[model samples]
Target: MELQTITIKREDYVSIVEINHPPANTLSSQTITELREAFQILKDDIDTHAIIVTGAGRFFVAGADIKEFTEAFGDYDAAFAMAEAGQALCDEIEQMKKPVIAAINGAALGGGLELSMACHLRLAAEDAVLGLPELNLGLIPAFGGTQRLRKLVDMPTALEMILSSKQVKGKEAAEIGLVQAAVKGDELMDTALTLANSLVAGKSMTSVKRALECVVQGADEALEHGLERERVKFAELFLTDDAKEGITAFVEKRKPDFKHQ
Candidate 1:
């Protein structure tokens, strides 16, 4: 499909999706639609074991396109649709079988930060800024940000960040568990790639996908239910060829060749 706002590149088993919108890289409706399409394609791409998302210039994504908000003003249904669209895209990214990593090279505010939060992993540049500043615009985060931020950090921290419209640097974000790691600007992409590779290299994608499902899909469920789901998945994995090979390799003391079955 033709994409105007994003570019997809392949590096071996990894797919790097870069937001190419200039200026602020704001998430206009067109940009969001293109992103959904790109990710949908990558989700089924067997060659792409993992994915990394980043932006083109100084801004990862400044925020959603405030200009578009004007079109929805005074129309509750239109506003609701906009919010639902953003939430659906985030939910899709969060539930992907293949891992998705956010390489935050620059500012990630409002919808940008929300998008990063939905990824399986996030690595931000030391100077990168991240926050949900929707409140500052007389609005609130409508893209699962409120829920994910609370789960990532403490409730109090999330409340404070949202209420105060506070933007934290990457280092502070890592300290609060908003991001996995913070590296220098020049090292952000390299660090993200290293992390993405480490997560899938020499590992069974079957196991990786199940583990992600247990964590992401079960996060909102009761502890008992989550454990039950994990147990069921664990037993189910044993029936797969990759799982059998992995166990045998453990006994043979050698790396198992995984076909990702």
Candidate 2:
């Protein structure tokens, strides 16, 4: 589907959603709305098993459109609403059934960093720079960055990054657990696609989705309860035809052909 602020290209079952705002690819209110719509389309696409999100040109996303905040000026309520809406978008991405990977091709600051945190995994180009620099504007990361950042790194590291507004290169970001890995700029998409395909290969979509749910929800629950839930999910997969085929193939030393059943 055509969109005003984003472009979607598909290769097999992986859909690549690129943020198309020129220059820095800043996320304005309208762009956010477009992103919401784009993601909804992907969510409904049965053939799309995984998604890679990136930006065109030299940026992944610099941040939210500063113009919106400047125009709002002192309207605290409007600003708060904007924060809530952006956070909701991040929440939607985090809760998506299919895996969403952030391919950071360049700078990802403030809201951009928050956006990356929302993805199931993040892969960045070697030259990419990431940070939460909203402090320079006398603001903070309002799009779940405060929470998600802590989850990715230690409390001290998260506090340092968010409060200091420090930018780190892609390799350093990966070293600190901000990204899964750093790849050469030219190989970013190829690396992202490879990871996306690996996630869905020879696996039942039902099990994959269930496992994601367990991991996401388990973070908030007690360990014993979470283990019990995982056990239940494991047992449930036994009833799936995909599981049967996988087990049979394993015993026969042959590759399994998963039907996503």
Candidate 3:
């Protein structure tokens, strides 16, 4: 697809998706649609083993386009649709088989933070700022932020951040487990790429796919149910060719050459 709001670049097995919306890189309707399309394509691409998302300019996505909010104002249906759209996109990202990493080079506020939260992993620049500042604009996070924030941080901290419209620097974000790590601005992309590559380095795509499913689909369920799911998947993997090769290679004391079958 011809992307107008984002750019996609391939680096061996990793696809770097950069939001190019100028200034603050706010998420407009077009930007959201384009992102959804881009990810959909990447999801099925065999050449891509992982994905990294970042922003072009100084902002990693400041927020949703405030101007678009005006169009949905006073229309309950319109506003509800908008929220659903954003939530759906985030859910897709969260459930993808291949891991997605957010390289937060600058500010990640409102929808931006929500987007990063959707990723399986996140790396931010030390100077990067992240938060859900919708309350400052007489609004609240509508794109799964209310649910995801509490999962990352405690209820009290999430409540305080949202209610007070607080923004945290990347270091504090890491301390609170909001992001995995924080590095220098110049090292953000390299760190993200390294993390992404490490996830798929010597693994079979079949195993990778099932592991992601086990975690994403099972995390929200009861312990018994999650265990049962994991057990079933573990048994099923034994039937795959990759599993046989991996087991035999262990016996031979050599690296297993995975065909990603």
Cα lDDT tens digits, model 3, 52-110, are 99999899999999999999879999999889889988999999999999999999999
Candidates 1 and 2 compared: the better one by lDDT is: 1
Question: Higher-TM-score candidate among 1 and 2?
Answer: 1
Tens-place lDDT digits, model 1, residues 1-261: 799999999988999999989899999999999999999999889999999999999999999999999998799999999999999999999999999999999999999999999999999999999999999889999988999999999999999999999999999999999999999999998898899999899999999999999998888889999999999999999889999999999999999999899
TM-score of 3: 0.98
Runs of candidate 2 exceeding 4 Å displacement: none
Show the colliding residue pairs in model 2.
Answer: none
RMSD per candidate (Å) reads 0.9, 1.5, 0.9
Candidate order by lDDT, decreasing, is 1, 3, 2
Instruction: Give me the displacement of residue 238 in model 1, in angstroms.
Output: 1.8
The better candidate by lDDT, 2 or 3, is 3
Q: Which ten residues in a row have the lowest lDDT in candidate 3?
A: 217-226
